[model samples]
Target chain A: MMDFISYTCLIVGVIFWFWGTIPLLSERSVLFKLHSLSVSDTLGSMSIIFGLLLKIPREWPLLVLAIVCLVLWNTMLGYVLAYCSSSGEKRENR
Target chain B: MVGHLIFRLTIWFLLTANLSWLNILIGLSISLLLPRGYTNPETLKEWLSILGKILWAIPLAYIEAFDLILRPHNDEDMVCEQVEKKRSHRLVFLDILLITFTPKTIVVKYHEEGWYEVHRVTRRKKP
Candidate 1:
């Protein structure tokens, strides 16, 4: 059951990772695309992590830390990407 | 280039911090996503430099961007004293500082003239 779930999570994560690539080719506003990509990445990564977390036997402390770090990293990535995109927008406007 | 290197290092460190075997996969993915230079460092020295750049750059970039957003109304000279910019590029913190904040007052170093002329807005403010 756990192996099946892990496989499912891996597949979902990969799908979202591939989906994350769309914004690059997108002709739409970068802000909007960034938001979309970030949401997908966060959801996909979180789901995959959760699925993996279920398999670990008893290392609660490290697992908790890993989860927290993952959340932090992904969330920050989203924010920075949005910011960089916005900065580029300012240059373009000028 | 420096910014890109810094970002790559962050990714690597974050993976290692998590003790993730996913490092190999993530590294591969990053290589596919970004340009080749950042991932293709040929030596330990090169990798360390890239990581150093990444760690240094992220915060500096944030501060520069923050200054730009905060002082949007300042059309005057946006001179500032701040930390370094990049290798071989003498971007005084004050200069790269503008790209994110008071950008208009910046006397950009244009290649055409090979000079950093006073910005029109800054000139207007001076005698």
Candidate 2:
């Protein structure tokens, strides 16, 4: 049961990774692509790390830390990227 | 104050993933020896609440992701939102993080006069 669940999580995470990245090819605005990308990427990475944690409980501390870093840094990075891109566009227009 | 120290120490322990006496001593020293930033005026209760909200956002984000995936042609809008009064930098950071972590919304800019320029993907209206 545990193995099944772990593999499921890993697979789902990969699906999310693809789902998020495919939109980058679309002609949507940068912010729109960014919104979807950050959300799914963060979720996918966390899910993958969680599956690993369940598979190797001995390395849980590190795995848990990875999840935390993924959530915090990914969110922050998303905000920073959005801010920079929008502001730079404004500067170009000026 | 104490919260900052504890936060840093927790990260150190997690990074090292060790519980030896020497490791603990090193972690403590490193956490303290680091240059401290200006004290955050926010109370512990508020901080914990914000953290809880962030944790809550995880599951919410997944739901939003599925919605975005299912409906790829959602309308997009950019609008300025008012920021809460007297928010500290840390709180503002958390606010932006929480907002952008969701799939449908991203904060494009934080204006100096307490406004956030947010870009949102909303569902299309039926004709």
Candidate 3:
């Protein structure tokens, strides 16, 4: 049962990663692409980490830490990227 | 202050997952040495409700994300035209975090007069 769950999580994580990338090839706006990529990547990474946590309960502390770091850093990075992109637009418009 | 110190030490212990005397000693000293920055909550009920909201937001985010990824055309309904009312900093931050965590919405800009421009990936109506 555990093996099945672990494999499922890993598979889903990989699928999400690919799902996020599909937008990059299209002619969407930069922000749209960034949003799709970042959110999917974060969720994929988290799901994989969670699978690992289940597989290796002994190292749960580190795995949990990894999850927290992924969540906090990914969100912060997105905000920073958006801010920088917006500010550049402002300078160009002025 | 004592309560804060204990909370910090407990977190340290949980992160390390070590129960050795040396680990405890080091954690105790480190926690004590760290600057005090914990803010007292007005009420436990308020804190619990905030935590509950966050917990609920996580699942909602996943549902929205999956829907967007599977059906990208639904983005039109998700996107808001404009938000005229001012939101508190805390609320704005939470909304941004929740929206960004999901693939459905991306905050484009914060225009003047409390207006927020968000972009959603959805199909447009043909003229």
| TM per candidate | 0.37, 0.92, 0.77
For model 1, the local distance difference test gives 0.48
**RMSD after Cα superposition, model 1:** 13.7
Candidate 1 backbone collisions, by pair:
B6-B54, B68-B100, B68-B101
lDDT of 1 by residue, A1-94 (tens): 8888877866766666666565568675554444345434554565566666766745544555566575556554544554566567779899
Q: For model 1, how does the per-residue alpha-carbon lDDT over B1-78 read when each residue is reduced to its tens digit?
A: 555555565656554554456875676567557765323324456446655764564345334333433443222332
Candidate of highest TM-score? 2
Q: Work out candidate 2's RMSD over C-alphas.
A: 1.9
Q: Show the lowest summed lDDT stretch of 10 residues, model 3 chain B.
A: B74-83
Model 2's CAPRI class is medium
Candidate order by decreasing TM-score: 2, 3, 1
Residue A48 in model 3: shift from native, Å? 1.1
Assess each model's interface with DockQ, reporting 2 decimals per model.
0.04, 0.80, 0.52
Global lDDT of model 3: 0.70
lDDT per residue as tens, model 2, A10-89: 88888889988887998988887887687568988878888888888998878888888888889888888988988898
For candidate 2, lDDT tens digit of each residue in B1-127? Answer: 7877888988988898999999999998988899977855998788899989987998998888777777774678888899667878888888988898887888888887899999998887546
The order by descending lDDT is 2, 3, 1
lDDT of each: 0.48, 0.84, 0.70
Alpha carbon deviation, residue B87, candidate 3 (Å): 9.4
- Where is the poorest 10-residue window by lDDT in model 2 chain B? B65-74
Per-residue CA lDDT of model 3 for A1-94, tens digit only, reads: 9988988888888888888888789986567777678657788788788788778788887787788778867876776677688679889989
